[model samples]
Target: MASPARSLNPTPPLKGSFPLDHFGECKAFRIDYLKCLKERDGAQYECRDVAQRYLQCRMDAGLMEKEEMSKLGYTKSNSNRRRVSQDSYKKSKESKGFIAGLSK
Candidate 1:
């Protein structure tokens, strides 16, 4: 069997974008992208994975601008704080597949 550890190469783009009905919503992952993902998937998902899939699903969507994920924190260069994996961070940024978002 292949390793689930093996990263998922991105396939074709999903056919959706962030909704406008949330005219008052925030643009960051927690609000905008989370709504997008929940609408895409019937069930709710965590922000990290949803954000990753969003960047994957939409080919032209802007990448997360923050240098560090709010969840994962910083790296060894961040000597003052505990370190985390940059590679893992990048991998998280990558999308696996469009597991949902099929209903629209």
Candidate 2:
């Protein structure tokens, strides 16, 4: 018996496509973010800075599309806001009880 011919069709990614960094252009930033994740015990929220850096590196290397940092949820004011929010969360947990803290 003869086998049927095979064909392949590829489509662009739903959100669009990005070039792969086969040259390891952003490998350092990727490593840093991964290390931060490990150090944070997989708490991604704590590694936002590192993750943002990694994205920035990818953009700079033309591995991904360039966009505003604010659009990506990072801005000069954001860092300050994050710090304040963390402080507030800590206070809420101490004074308002766990359930009340979550509301904050």
lDDT of 2: 0.83
Q: Stretches of candidate 1 above 4 Å error?
A: 1-32, 36-46, 60-104
lDDT tens digits, residue span 1-104, model 1: 86677778977545334444243223454466657656756333323465554444332343323233333432334432221454454355555433345632
Each candidate: what lDDT? 0.44, 0.83
Stretches of candidate 2 off by over 4 Å are: 1-15, 83-104
- Clash-forming residue pairs, model 1: 40-101
For candidate 1, what's the RMSD? 19.1
| Model 2 TM-score relative to the real fold | 0.62
Give the alpha carbon lDDT tens digit for every residue of 2-97 in model 2: 999998898779657877789999999889889998987786767888889889999888888889888988887887778779878778787856
CA RMSD for every model? 19.1, 7.1
Relative to the true structure, candidate 1 reaches a TM of 0.19
Best candidate (score: lDDT): 2
Residue 102, candidate 1: how far off, in angstroms? 47
Clashes of 2: 0
